[model samples]
Target: MGRAWILCKKMFSLTLVFNALLTIACCVGILAGFYWYYSGWNPFAPYLVNGNLLWFAIAAAAINIFPSALLGRKLHTGRFLFHHYFYGFLVMASAVIYVVLFTSVPLTTIFLVNNTSPEVNVGRFFLLGGLTLLLDDLPDVSKRIESGLNHIKAGANRMRKVIVAAQVVTGAFSLYIFAAVCAAMLTIPEWVTPANLILVFTVLITGVTAFIFVKRKAWNNLIVNGEENSH
Candidate 1:
């Protein structure tokens, strides 16, 4: 059981790191695309920009929802809570803000701008990427948070509740966004651009895989270590 837990931890860590790298790549690609657009020299800009690189970054950040929750459950540590729940909240909150202030708003409104602009989206991309890297690189902070939370009465239970609540809310919001995007695609088939399809399918696959992995691992852990230590 202990070994199994370790294996899960390692896999989770690797996944987080990979996400961080992917986020960085997406950010770089967006920057490059912008440069190419302005300077008109790079051949790759069309591919990167048309690919909806920013959306991919958002999807990458959003996909972390699953692994973050899994790590929170497995570690039951303060660091994981901060990294997964708190930071996760920030990411989703930003998405909500983007939708409300930009995407969902009418172009005639005061807030009107290119919602798809790389300049507009890059900020969130960097924020998400930076946070993921911070989570990966800063173990001491996470451990300290974990220790602090442990010192509080019923901290573990409270933290668990918070994590669960965040996950539920985030999941619902993501679904809502996905549905909205699909509706827009249907309304204007041209909106079903390559990037939109990629984002939808990527999120679908990532969500399903995360669900299966977390459920199977929980079941296996229960069998290996029994209910008492499984938590």
Candidate 2:
């Protein structure tokens, strides 16, 4: 399982995510950059309103994509509570921004519907809850689900990217393993004799040769054969 999960981008960096100043900087940069890039915005919502399939896909992705990334990472433990809450706050903030700035719905109508507790904005709560669920992937529940989805059924048409992954893993894993072994040889003086070093280099060269051969074989089909990748 560990070997299989080597490909996952856990995003567990504390410096990148947990730092208060860095987080604020990142948020400001993203929002300001996007606003500057597009002077005017049009929420031509469901961009292709004429096409139900496209609209449905867009809506589905908007609601599900974040959850999918979280699910793939499976980051739902006590340690990740900060991420959970932070992302939750982001969702609510986004909803609030939309409501206050762009929503055509009246504030009174949005709030008056809540009878349980007038102080508790039901409208905001509904949107907040939705955003929280959509973003809360609860990754630990299905830690390996991402890898499982990656193992797509192979076919001539679908195998293009998969083949590249296989080839790279084959070559890269070999080099990575050999590099560690070479590093290990230095643990103790005179532990790795000159004879052993020579043998290791010989094996390393052999492995690299195989990697190159497979790479060229791939190029033969990808470039020499003049076949463009599938969209």
CA RMSD of each candidate after superposition: 13.2, 21.5
Q: Whole-model lDDT for model 1 versus the true structure?
A: 0.44
Worst lDDT window (10 residues) for model 2?
13-22
lDDT per residue as tens, model 1, 1-231: 876776577457546544534443433444455555445543123333333334443443454543443353445323444444455456646654664565443423211232455544544454454455445433334656544533532343445444444434444443444455566677777767654664455444344443443344422222111211112
TM-score: model 1 vs. ground truth = 0.38
Q: Which stretches of model 2 miss by more than 4 angstroms?
A: 1-49, 59-67, 75-83, 90-134, 137-231
In the range 95-132, model 2's lDDT, one tens digit per residue, is 66666665555544443221223233434454435344
Once model 2 is optimally superposed onto the true structure by TM-score, how far is the C-alpha of residue 18 displaced, in angstroms? 19
